[model samples]
Target: MGILDGKNILVAGVTMHTSIGYKVAELAQQEGATVIVSNFGRAMSLTGRVIKRLDPVPALIELDVTDDEHLAGLADTLREHVDHLDGVVHSIAFANPETALGGRFLQTSWPDVGQAVHVSAYSLVALAMACRPLLGRGSSIVGMTFDATVSWPFYDWMGVAKAALESANRYLARYLGPDGVRSNLISAGPIDTLAKKAIPGTEEFNRVWGERAPLGWSTTDSVPAAKGVLSLLSDYFPATTGEIIHVDGGLHATGS
Candidate 1:
């Protein structure tokens, strides 16, 4: 039997097949979870096309986390497909490449930084609360992150946003713990997905991981990170919460 058998999961922010979110949905379904995938704006079309490759195509929903209406109505929208959610994978993050990223940190406008934090960090709490009614004991809330403990070139404001994300995760665990809900994050190594392509100097990340990651890292392979997310969603990590699991091939552990 699959580890996630009988569970209902929502994987938000999926677009291309190469995306980690897509990989998570694919594996979740393969492991017996009923998966619903979501994206916003024009990317919804791409997500629609890619998810068809799954054995049982998942339902695609439009969710702009910045939209109060979208966040407020999330659970109701989800109910049309599944009675309840056993897990929620938050795979969403964004920052303006023009102003907030690529070493533009000091010059980035408040609006851009605000947008980054809103979408990348606060949305974790927003999404969790929106799905709170559907979640019960043993329900898992997992988010994706880059290791925000240290800064990286070109990561700039997005790195600050990720730091906020990491902090928000701990707070979510504190508040949601009372409800028996668990919140955690996966700090993954750089993968060459469409999202990564948008970030300037991504090649630098690949080079760093290649040289330092003791277990080695692959910019092309997303399966290892996806597997880490699944493990968190499964019953195997029942006692784990408010933690950050590094799936960066030991890169996070390396000291310079």
Candidate 2:
């Protein structure tokens, strides 16, 4: 039997066929979850093309995480599918283009950092809470993150936001645990996603991933990270929470 048979998953941030969100939704379905995807305004058309890529098209929901209207509307939208959610995969992130792409940390303004943190880090908490009424026992909420151990070139405000994301995972786990809800983050290595456009030194991250990762690295395949996301979405991680599992081909463990 599939690990998530009859379960419903809400995957946010699918923009294109090459998107990591696309890969996660694809694998979640393969693992037997009833997947519902989410996309924003201008990106809505792109999501339709991505849905066609799925073997059996999953339902699509409109969600722009930063919009209060979208947040309030989510529960109603979810009602069209199942009454509750088994899991949520948050692949959403962003930064003011000007604040990223090698922008100096000192040069970034609070408005830009606020936006970065709101959309990327704080949304995880919002996602869990907004779905709380619908998520009963055994329901999981998983988000994506980078190492956040140290800063990377061109990462700028996004890096600071990821640190907040890491911290938020712990807080969510503690607060949500009593009710059987779980929160976790997948610290994936640098993958070639639209989000990566913010990182100024892209070539450096790619080179580091290939050299430091003991298992070797290829940014082409997001399947490994997709699997990690699915693992947390399933009952397999029953006792796991407030954790940041690395899916970076051992890059985080390498010395020197």
Candidate 3:
């Protein structure tokens, strides 16, 4: 039997086949989990088309995390597909390319910063609460993050947002722990996904990872990071919560 056999999982923020969420969804199914995928706006159509590649294509739902109505009715909507969720993969984040990222940290407006924090960080809590009714003992919540402990050349506000995400994860673990639920995040190395392309100086990240990552890093392959997410979602990490697992080829351990 697979690690996640008979589990119900919802993976949010899948749009393209190149995305980490896509890989997570694909692998989750292979590991015997019944996966439901979600996206919002125009990307929903892209997510719908891309998931068809899976054996029994997962159900795709629209979830704009920033919307109160969507968050409020999430569990009800989710009930249509599955009775309960064993895992929720929160793979959502966003920041304005022009004002909130790429060295414009000092100039970013509050609106842009708020949007970034709301989507990237706060949504983790929102998603968990929205799914709380369907979650029970042994349930897990996992989110994606870039290393937020240090600053990067062009990461700017998005870096700040990730830091918030890290902090929010801890709080979730603290509060959810009472219910036997776990919350954690995976801090991954740079991968050449569409989201990375939106950042102005993403190439610098690849160069740094290639130079410093002890195990080497690939900009194209997302499977390693995806695997990290799966591990957290599975029974393997039963007692681990409020933790940040790095899947960045050991780069986070290096000084330079």
Which candidate has the top score in lDDT?
3
The window of 10 residues in a row where model 1 has the poorest summed lDDT is 97-106
Candidate 3 segments whose C-alpha is farther than 4 A from its true place? none
TM-score, model 3 to reference: 0.99
Q: Rank candidates, lDDT, best first.
A: 3, 1, 2
- Which should have the higher lDDT, number 1 or number 3? 3
* Residue 243 CA displacement from its true place in model 1, Å: 0.1
Tens-digit lDDT track of model 2 for 116-135: 89999999888777778889
Model 2 clash tally, residue pairs:
1
Candidate 2 vs 3: which has more TM-score: 3
Error of 2 at 7 (Å): 0.7
lDDT of 2 at 72: 84
Off by over 4 Å in 2: none
Each model's lDDT comes to 0.93, 0.87, 0.96
Per-residue lDDT over 1-256 for candidate 3, one digit per residue giving the tens place of the 0 to 100 score: 8899999999999988999999999999999999999999888888889999998999999899999999999999999999999999999999999999989999999999999999999999999999999999999999999999999998998999999999999999999999999999999999899999999989999999999999999999999999999999999999999999999999999988
On a 0 to 100 scale, what is the lDDT of residue 85 in model 2? 95
How high is each candidate's TM-score? 0.99, 0.97, 0.99
